[model samples]
Target chain A: MIKKGDTIPGIFSVLFGVLILAYIKTNEKMVVMSADTYGGIGPGFFPFVCAVALVICGVLLVLRGIKQNGNVDYFQLTPERKENLKSVVMLAALVFIMLLAWKVSKMFFLCLPIYVFAVNKLLKRSWLFTILFTVGMTLFIYLLFRVGFHIRFRP
Target chain B: MSFELLMSAFLDLLTPSVFLYMSIGIILGTAIGALPGLSATMGVALVTPITFWLDKVDGFAMLMGLWNSAVFAGGITAILINTPGTPASITQAWDGYPMYKRGEGGLALGINVIFSFVGGMISILLLILLAQPIADFTIKFGPAEYALVALFGMTMMIAVSNGKVVKGLMLGFLGLGLSTVGLDPVTGLKRFTFGNMGLQSGIAFIPVMIGLLGLGEVFYQMYDYNKKRAAEELEARKINQSLGRVIPTGKEMKKWMPRNIIVGLAATVIGAIPAAGGDISAIICWGNSKRFSKDGENYGHGSAEGLSVSSTANNGVIGGAMCTMLTLGIPGDAVTAVLLGSLMMYGMTPGHTMFTEQLDFTAQIMVLMVLANILFLIIGLATAKISAKLLNMSQPTVWAAVGVLCIVGSYCISNSYMDVIIMFIMGILGFFLKIYDFPSGPLVLGLLLGGMIEKNVRTALIISQGDWGYFVQRPISLVLLILIGASFLFPVVQGILKKKKAPAAE
Candidate 1:
């Protein structure tokens, strides 16, 4: 079982590197001149420095991981553990269905039943309770965001 | 600080809309916290869109409620299934799961809930009373001071990583670098977008959070799911029957009351500091409880004190984090980062002027925190047993639902399909990172702090006429710098001293 303690920093380093490279590429003009005095360096200067520092840190991390025998093994998914994959999928489906219902038909209330049914079927929960929970949640969202705040359902 | 202003602020917060928003927060917090792999940060991020249309007070109130309740409720899943709902609750599962196996799950959860409530409420009270003074003190800090504060926050990762100073610093700098993505805040130039449109805005914080915390867990779970189970595993894993009564005995409560209060207070104070959060508080408290307890050996075997200490410390941080955000305009955690964004969306920028100018808004959020705590206690107790049944569900069904939620959450953020793609990519990256030994907290922290660090550095330097001396000249900045320096060196020095003392003691 991969623990949280095992995996966060590596992904962060790569992502940080990607971000730095991206920033440097996008704002080319900002890098060239110290036009404004946000500091002794131009506005781009701090971010550029921060980015370089981040890359150095990332390189060190990858090296450390290699030294510790860390690699793709941390990312491997075993078959038995795949049973729990349904949780993430179910949550994603719920959101997709809700958004689809609301977006296509503007029938925000329709999403409530789907939510209830999904929760019920997935948890093997009591139908009565699931229904109540679904309805309660739907109504709460409606009343709070739609009715009270007067937000329009995205069309 | 005027009486009239305070009265009006109180009135603004007491309105029915604020209560309604707070209620929504509590309910959402409980649901998200009760689920395994779902974290409070993700919950807040997903819910932020709902608040986009709300009034400033109502939106802030809701986020606050969610923040407090989510941290407390995370223990529910940990106690029941040995799976922590949030990173902060991971330590709780150490003792909590053992207690569950010993058939004291209900009692453990009950104790955890009560202590969490007490811890959260006390912290809120502290925030309400001390916010102005703290803000006033913190406001004295300038750019150099903020940089120092950021440095101090980064250095604390040493304590967090458990003596792994090199790894912690590596991770912290990595986070700081990731934050540098997107167009420079002051100069409008991009640093590292790599010709990708999505990269133009830099890396989105929500995607990183969802990927690292949420998807990363999924990958780990998949690995565990592949492991073959012993025949007895099914029987051993069956949940224990409820103990009927929810509350602990009066004697038991009385014995732990003083300790609980002390733990709660200490946790709150620590939590108020930026980058330090519930996870750190809970672990620190749990460690301290073991160190001090006469029955320390029983800690992982169903000790009520252990549960109380961990839960209290975790929940206590919510209010403390809020104090930093409302008073000093610095969000202490991811949830508050979303809240800060919401505040910006509502055209309400939090600062010294916010207290004097937007007193009502500030008061409303404070009141909502108190109300949310009460609601969380009531709802949490009532739903404890029932919520645990989620663990029994078939795997496929649950995955389908979560998949839907991820899609919806991503799409809702900007009403853009591109964001969904970004979310998916992040999720994959997060999964891979989890397989490798890396910390995601610093990455998230970097993403959250990156823009602010850039914007502030520029503003501060401009004001100082491009003089570096200005940063050192300010009293507040000088103090913060010293503190940052101390934080960085403390662990290294301590480790060396320990190494030297070890041979002498031997």
Candidate 2:
């Protein structure tokens, strides 16, 4: 049976599978045909088969979801569901911001601890502990990576 | 298998560095493993480079200890916070967390630690006894057999998943599809790089894993500040008047020992497969044990039997994984993949020769596994209080910090920012998977086995000059195919029987 939860995912998965299959068909590199290989099967063969299978599965799920959705309205979101949606959206945005900061600064030492502390603080942790934990962990990671393993982080 | 093997193994254990490095690994492994967003795989991957500078024995001892102990420690979070540190510890959350809620936090942790040791010891013994014979038998294995066996392993995981079989299959097949995005194994041509240099080598599962399990959990828990779990954890901490018994009573121990052995054996067998580990082992064994136990209905509530099975399966898996890695060149899981890479770096190739030529080194690793289990037992017991209390700490701070570690761990894989980006994408994907009730285990396992399946299929085809019959013509492959057919049919038959039985019971 289809529910709101399954419906979106079903559509997404189906579209994704279709797009991948289409890409594989168009990309000549994926299809390797030679006189000296694999039971007439090429690299693209397995992937192509997998994509079609995934699409079929996805279509089944979509049909099930649609049938279920026809009986039940999912427009009303409970507070808990709303909160979950909010939390996921906010985290996604936060990570996007973190990525931008990293790309701009190229300094984990500077950006990582700041966001770590800020996130913890936003979640209602004590400022002093958040700051201390953030700094301590950042230093530990820096030392462990930079000095211990001799891995160089981009400046 | 012999006294001499045992004697030499014990002799290899005599070195102080073996104990010293292992102790260091245990402490680090326990800490990382107890934390959400960090796992045994991450711990091993991070320390692998560091181990290169040390002596071979010390380095390997450290790695082995790190693996076993980290797996054991995942249950700490599972028990304390109802948040599993790894998927391997999910059952611990199922039963152990409930026990903690009933003010048996210490007892839960104790059972987890003790049974984990039990599992480890039992598996190690099996490793010593069976590794050689299994390797010898598999020496005659061909590409067709390998292909069938690997396929069998993946489907077995899906069939045993405590979820909708179709959902598990979908995710698994999708994961296999995703795995083919990189350069074609047989053709040496890029398949789905799409002009990105980073895409050529394919996505490293470690980063993707950290994002999915670790960061995804953090994001999911960000809702309502995870106040519900944090409140329960803190309340459990305050309500405990006594730490209770970290060691089970002798009678209690005797009661569980037999069942634990069965779970341990089952786990060990599963663990020997290159594509399986504690996650699948724990799930299957735990499910089986629950069904047989008198208090089967009490399983998910607060049954010690359920916790014991889960706990035992965790470390019980390591010895089996090591058996496969040492005997076969193939990895047993992501962690063993790292180990295999290390072995290759040392100019050692695993095969029939590894048993004969590298016998000493293999013995050394076995001894190290045995010692590590002992050391962790002592260490885990001593620090159970501190670890149990870790969940009582501020949730915001712990999880927020874990998020950062996830980022850093992904980046540390190859010191690439691209890896971090991949982690984010994977994190989002994993978040959705969880939200949609798709099992992540199958996907991860699929990615691990996908390469083997592709390589073996192409190799067999190439060798047979495009003969479709090559797969079934060989005896081993034929037998393996029958087994694969059985696996797919088993679930359907069971479902039919279950449906038939329900009405009769009514």
Tell me, by TM-score, which candidate is best.
2
Off by over 4 Å in 1: A1-28, A32-38, A62-155, B1-17, B90-106, B155-159, B162-183, B189-204, B215-220, B227-240, B293-297, B394-396, B494-506
User: How well is each residue in B201-233 modelled by candidate 2, as lDDT tens digits?
Assistant: 887766767777667766766643445665776
TM-score (C-alpha) between model 1 and the true structure: 0.78
Displacement of residue A46 (Cα, Å) in model 2 is 2.4
Off by over 4 Å in 2: A1-3, A32-38, A70-77, B1-21, B28-63, B70-112, B224-226, B244-267, B270-314, B324-361, B503-506
RMSD of model 1 against the true structure: 5.8
Report how closely model 2 matches the true complex, as a DockQ value: 0.51
**lDDT of model 2, residue B310:** 96
Cα deviation in Å at residue B402, candidate 2? 2.0
